[model samples]
Target: MSTTETNSGTAPAQSASALASKNPATGDVISVHAIQSPEEVRAAVERARSAARSWNALGFDGRKQHLLRWVSYLLDHADELSELIHAENGKPVDDAYLELVLAVEHIAWAAKHAKKVLSPKKVAPGLLMANFSAVIEQHPLGVIGVIGPWNYPVYTPMGSIAYALAAGNSVVFKPSEYTTAVGNYLADSFRLANPELREHILTTVNGYGETGAALVTSGVNKIAFTGSTPTGKRIMAAAAESLTPVLLECGGKDAAIVAADADVKAAADAIAFGAMANSGQTCVGVERVYVDKRVSDEFITEIKKIIRDLKPGDAEGASYGPMTMPSQIDIVRSHIEDALEHGGRAVVGGADSVKERYIEPVVIVDADETCSAVVEETFGPTLTIRTVDSADEAIELANASRFGLASTVFSKNHGMEIARRLRAGATSVNSVLGFAAIPALPFGGVGESGIGRIHGEWGLKEFTRPHAIANQRFAIPGMALLSFKRTKMTTSLVKQTMKLLHGRYK
Candidate 1:
């Protein structure tokens, strides 16, 4: 699972002009990947465009077999792929394995449901056009360019890649520079699975942000981008140059609400895992928790017990690994400091918890709502607990952020009621981040969190456009409705029908 092995299997070895992928935990150079120039990105998009027609012609069944084969290939090599994820992303081995499992499930789901979701279906022509037979179908948007994030690199990106391919479009992926090796490994595996179509199918363009910018404007039919909000906006703007539609999955300041009747222990465990897993680098990771005032003390006690002994390091038994991005450490530190300065009390770790690369879990209580720690996305293993007078207040506070990504509600009753009230893309009742594990659920957010969705049927449609067709069944005798020779009798009949349908409804 060495970097050279990963890169060589898919394509030729990286040339001298390449970027180094370093391990965030140890600061070791894990692999060298060729930095694709803008020209190279455009070339990859062109290749995908050329291959899309034949791939789509294979139809749903043909594509399903190839995608299922990819699933099997990925499952067979899960351990190896997980190792690459660990080496590059600094996540614990088990976490990386879980990510791979979810990614495989998404691919399988997309393949199995593509036809059912995207196939043409008859539609009623309405009374005004009863003589016409109408239908609608989803057609591939040609080539799709995906800009993936580093955290959960495999799972997050595949949400776009798998569905885009399932819907009959060729993909040109630009993985995060930090996880270039992992991306190359996936592309290589896909090529191996479909060797005959390798030249026209999935392609990987390894590089930094500039490479991603190039991909956005690479003349692809559409772009699916997952990253920070600012970056998502930039990608959208770049794609606008080509009028290429973009689906953005951006950052989230997700919140978890605990009702008075919730099971304290279960809620504590779920929140702890949701907040600290992957060192809190998840896009929908739990960053805030609003609890009922009646049970705030009990909830805090239970959560503290769950995380008190947890450690953050690269050790075998550590709860999580180091921060994937070095710059993120400063962000985490600043958030913790701001909370403490704004009338917040640290229940677990605080300013001293942030190390060179690893950040011990930090839990702050009673932080001011306006503080940066509570208002912005920290993307670290930090949680801010704020007590609310009632469930309504909790919902209000949760919906206060500009981000409306994902949320969780823990309650013995009224879970669904509260979940529906939260203005987020998805909500998990009685659990944290459970929506992500369900392949059928759509994932994305509203407002500043970004637009569009990935996963299930929504994901299939995101990479396609609707094409409607209508056929005239039989023309009425002497109708001439569409001709200059339209008869007065036909006009009178049509007017009378419209009046009968609408004039007396009330």
Candidate 2:
């Protein structure tokens, strides 16, 4: 209900004391504002539902105009927005800019591709149903509830948010408590460009667990959630009460495989970014690196050199930023301790590297399979290096996980082949997290990594429902049926036709 303007003039900055947006680098409060009460949350949803009806009525072209406005607004304030994201999330400024660029690209992709992918298509009615013609199309699901994560705060949430909007649905976003300010900024900016859509298009609610739960229970037609596997399960269970459909992008223990034929320097550089960028807080960040024995020594040496060049600080030249969440430091420390206890060797930095708010990158080898560092989601700046016999063995180890969000393969000889073998939502051949930037690719994972997808066609459909219409042509009464004398001949003809159409083949 209240809107404020920041430097970009999107919205006024909320007082950090009231809402509390902290600087990940210094653990200082950036700003804060009022938290929305349950009643206010419901009211927002109501406004969105009302807006959805009119927005949907605008049809394809009308919705596209609104999307373009949002894109323009995002581009106009990208620098200021990126700075805000960096300050709040502790990711490097470049990485923050990258997220903003990709978020804008995704908006463009969703706007341009939604109609083509979701439009009606005619299907053959087959055999006994030959007299009927069928068509299937997507319909808006009304209100969508999005619960986003802090990592890649802009792009991650926008995956669902943009697609939901493209599909003609209103969204009420509840971003991670750690990144609420960014969420508020995005929602407020969207309203500014399309004030006519203020009530219907987008809204933000700030809080922690209870707030997220309330959004899931606010009678939204669908929910799109991105977070840890444990929390994803809880969201699913909560939505079951309302039978609301959900799309979850959960945790991942994603691995980067280095083949014997890989360029060691390139491989090491890729691993460094995949593992240490954003202080290694990405859900799809490289947690483990498996190299062929033939290249193990060389790969480790190369990775260590890159790791040594990295510095953790709050400055521009620093390769790594501070941990966004303070509690994450303890978890990172615990994982390092477990890895050491299990006979792991720290090739670079170690436990003492954890500062008040920043965590330096630590590379460890000889990590036991059962060690928490190897098995759990540290979500910090750390990497475990392991060696295997061949690409097959590398993939085998990589696929052996409860989480399968994303992966990377660095084999010049057979990168795509090996990448295809990993059980993950997206795999980048010779690159890290490259698939995330391609708005055409559907993003999500399988098994414990979570279900459903966001991005591309799948993302658009996730927030909409199928509206099937079958128009009856004319009443066709068989000559035998008109007399109400269903003869054996007519029955025999029907049976014969069914067999001819659907009989099992040899």
Q: Whose lDDT is greatest here? A: 1
**Residues 1-506, candidate 1, lDDT per residue (tens digit)?**
11111100122223446978888889888988778888988888888888898999999999999999999999999889988899999998998999999999999999999999999989999976778999998999999888887888899999999999999999999888778899989999998887777475898998766677788777888888887877777777767777889898888899999999999899999999999999988878899999999999999999999988789888688799988777778888998999999999999989999999899889999999999999999989999999999999999999999999999999998999999999999999998888898999999999998889999889999999999999899986867678898889989998998898889967
Instruction: Give me the displacement of residue 213 in model 2, in angstroms.
Output: 1.1
Per-residue lDDT tens digits of candidate 2, residues 330-373? 88899999998998999999998887888888999979988999
So what's the TM-score on candidate 1? 0.96
User: How many residue pairs clash in all the candidates, one count each?
Assistant: 0, 9
Candidate lDDT (C-alpha), each = 0.88, 0.85
lDDT of 1: 0.88
